[model samples]
Target chain A: MATDAPRRGAAIGWYVLLSALSLIVLFPVWMTIARALSDGSATLFARTPSVLPYSPIQWDAFSRAFTEGGLGRPLLVSGLVTLIIVAAQTATAVGAAYAFAFLEFPFKRIVMVLCAATLLLPIEVTLIANIQTLQEVGLVSPSQGFGEAIGALTLPFLAQAFGIFLIRQGFLGIPKDLRDAAQLDGYSDLGFLRRVAVPVTRPVIGSFVLIAFLSAYNQYVWPRFSVKTNRWDTVQLALRRFGLDNPDQLNLGFAAAIIAALPVLVLLLVFQKQLIRGLTAGAVK
Target chain B: MGKRRNVRQWALAYALLLPSLVVFAVFAYLPLYRLVHFSLYQQSSRLGGGERYVGFGAVWDVLSGERFLQGTWITIKFLIFTVPAGIALGVLLAMAAHRRLKGIKIFQTIFSSTVASSVAVSSVVFLTLVNEQIGLLRNVSWLSLKSPNSALFAAALSSVWQNLGLTFVIVLAALQTVPEELLEAAHLDGYGAVRRFFRVVVPLISPALFFLAIVLVVYGFQAYAQIELITGGGPLRSTETLLYRITKLQKNTDLQVGASMSLGLFGLTFLVALVQFRLLERRVTYGN
Candidate 1:
């Protein structure tokens, strides 16, 4: 709305400021990728090249990290774990949210309060007893076994209160008349859940899936508690191994770092809306 | 027939709740019940061998001891370093990108890019820069890893950056929800852009800011991966917050100690959450 001179100057100023801030935010990531692609180890003094990757980029870093640093194995484990968790949690949310939304059960109100209470009990607080239970049940091995590692990782997160709470919000929005109408059509409880209810809550289920997947994939602390070495490392745990390794593999660790972060970056870009929706669900009210 | 059907419906509902009930029972209630239960009993072995009943003494020791207080002070320092900056930057980013300037979507994506990176990914990225021997950013005041103070600062830097995306997205969404006409009205009333943002926009977005505070506080105390990755609780255990201390205790030494410390952390988190709910949550202004 203004004349050309000040407006153009203001726009240029904004661009400068925004780009500088963006560069600051993106700098670490950029540096990691830059390191991953370079020819040599970047010592603090003078060996470090200009900010971008050096010429003749080291593509072997990615492949080496994939094979040597054992990045591929953890990636597979993380994927499988994320898949199992997302499916299991979503199904559990459907059942629990269904009961809370529609069906009558004993101590329903008390159960609802307890479900809310679960939000307060973070995984860190419950680490000791949970690990004990896992050990006693032989789900985790002190010597580093996948049986225990997988069990310990997947079980604690099988049902999240946030997932149940989110689905219940969706279910509450379903009209009573719709359920009644389904009943008139001889839709049994399970039938309505399978058909109408599930379809109607697609957005909620989608958000739950993304959230659960991220939660399972991004686990760092639990993996340490579950497995001693890199044998059962999730990508997050594996990243630590790569971060601290000897000189040659150190470069691959940088590559592996980007590799570990790629899927999440893709997820954030693809499901930005759902991710935001899931994140802000608590914030809104 | 109706009575029989009602009973069947109740049975069906109960059956439906079984998986969630079992999961919650095993994961939530059992751990919760056992956190206190085990804290009361002293385990002789790291893997829970001998049991000596210690009652509330462990919890008391954990709360009143120097280690726990040291961790508490570090946790508070982390909060001070991260949360206000987190909220303020969130608001700033939202303000900058909330405007419909040229190519704003690109800037928006750039502003929110950190959301994609998790604690591990971000820590790895930060560690590459802050390593004492080889760090690109080692010379900086806070990112240096040799000293405990700067090492903890390095960990805090990662946490703050990692949280930026979530905070920015939440505040941006809150900004977008603020009606445009309100800002235009303020503009007509002679309020400058900065004044309008602080006076008009902030009150409306206080709910989002309040929510960010709660999440950041939770994130502050519960942060583990960054500390573990960046400094490994470092030079003098300076970077060790409560969660790091508890996990280290569990992994390295006795189960009872970790359990007791976990209980202390739980209590603190609850007290802080309750205080925030009581103190700051009321000032949050909801919209029409």
Candidate 2:
């Protein structure tokens, strides 16, 4: 009983400490939400930050953000671009990983090395030249149409080496006997990949998909530089313009930021497991 | 027949790899080749003038230039401010939430919630939070938003906060991998909690820590939106990282200088990455 008291006290102390830490961690996000929902006039003049939304929550900021801030178009463009990139990346990665994992071929080592080398050359390193390349390809021009701009946005990201490596790891984990068994059952190479390898590696593929979506959705630099016009701005780029272009409507900007972030947040909540797995994929063994 | 079969298999394998190969060639290898090519020649000052061959001069000028050096220093400073602090905070949060206490999941979720925030979102959140006039931290004297020197720190603060979720998640995962018996044995010994953590837990999770360090360093180097959205690399260009400078050159249509700077940034990143692997990999204790 004497020791129990101290242990209980320690537990309570931990609870308190953790609660405070959580608040600190959550404060920025909560404050953003509060400011987004608060009356613009009150928020502009308020000296102390309110912990919650001001009474009679002003929902007009969201409408203004959606329309006047031009968030609606960006949301569509970002979603379409993210979907295209994710789908293409998954297809390309799965194909490349399938070849790497299950097939024997000449110059495989050199090809693998070349693929891995791309990991070092991030988009930032290749930014200026890539822009030139896209321009040369007529994908990004002064008068580039909508489709060309979307191509510019999604082309460089169509295939990722990390995705290949991750999916290959998954494919490599399938036992040789399983492949042999499928082959003996008269399954063709592509057929075996479709039925056996893919089903077995769904978790890895799912993880890759979630991570790819998150990254594609959150992409800032490429879109910011590549897309010359506001017509094709991704949500991130749009938010930047919205915030910078509308300094007076700070609440509107905040509201748009929240609106932009909501999709990924919901995705994170739903796909938390795969997201964590994909993120920590290379961190662990 | 067997030769034909082998040839067919090779064909299929090559076919499967074609998409990635083409993309890599055009976007990755070709750009790298062009960057070198562009850096070797200087564009004429006239708008439509052709190129002039200037082998290594542009690269040397950019690499040795003041802006490059200053940007490099600022990037290094940004790394210094963000990486270690991010790691320490991650470890702290992970340890706090690693216990078997009730409702710990909620705390873990909260700690990692920032992972949902995109760079732009996180930047805007911090920008609003640290605004000069009506910001939550406006009254806080030490972190003055108007100061040039503290602008980098302010940007770093947003980065650190934004990255906390990823760091916490990764570290918490690492913490869960620590063996119960090992900790118990350390506890059974004369080692106190802090000593035991350092002696036993630290080495055990060194790989994850190393991984986190590399990731955070890369992230710190790649940081643009945070600086752009938060400080705009401003108050006398105090937060202008290497990437930021490259983008500035890009904006100015100085592709030659930008290409050289890009290569320089690449070289710097490669060197830092090499140093990290050399210095840190030796200490990482990978559990069997």
- Cα displacement (angstroms), candidate 1, residue B77, comes to 1.3
Largest lDDT belongs to which candidate?
2
Candidate 1 wrong stretches, greater than 4 Å: A1-9, A40-50, A54-57, A243-245, B45-49, B251-253
Query: Mind giving the per-residue lDDT tens digits that candidate 1 earns over B1-288?
Result: 988888998888778778877888888889888888777877765444467888886778877889888888888888898999899888888787787688988888888888878888888888667877666777787677888878888888888898889898999888888889999999999999889988998898898899999999998988998888888888888888888887767542366677788888888999999999889867878766
Say which candidate scores most in DockQ: 2
For candidate 2, the per-residue lDDT at B214 reads 94
lDDT for each candidate structure: 0.82, 0.88
Local lDDT at B218 for model 1: 90
- Interface RMSD, in order shown: 1.7, 1.3
What TM value does model 1 have?
0.95
Indicate the worst ten consecutive residues by lDDT in candidate 2 chain A.
A241-250
* True-structure Cα RMSD, model 1: 2.2
Docking class of 1: medium
After superposing candidate 2, which stretches have Cα over 4 Å from the reference?
A: A1-3, A45-57, A244-248, B139-141, B251-253
RMSD of each: 2.2, 1.8
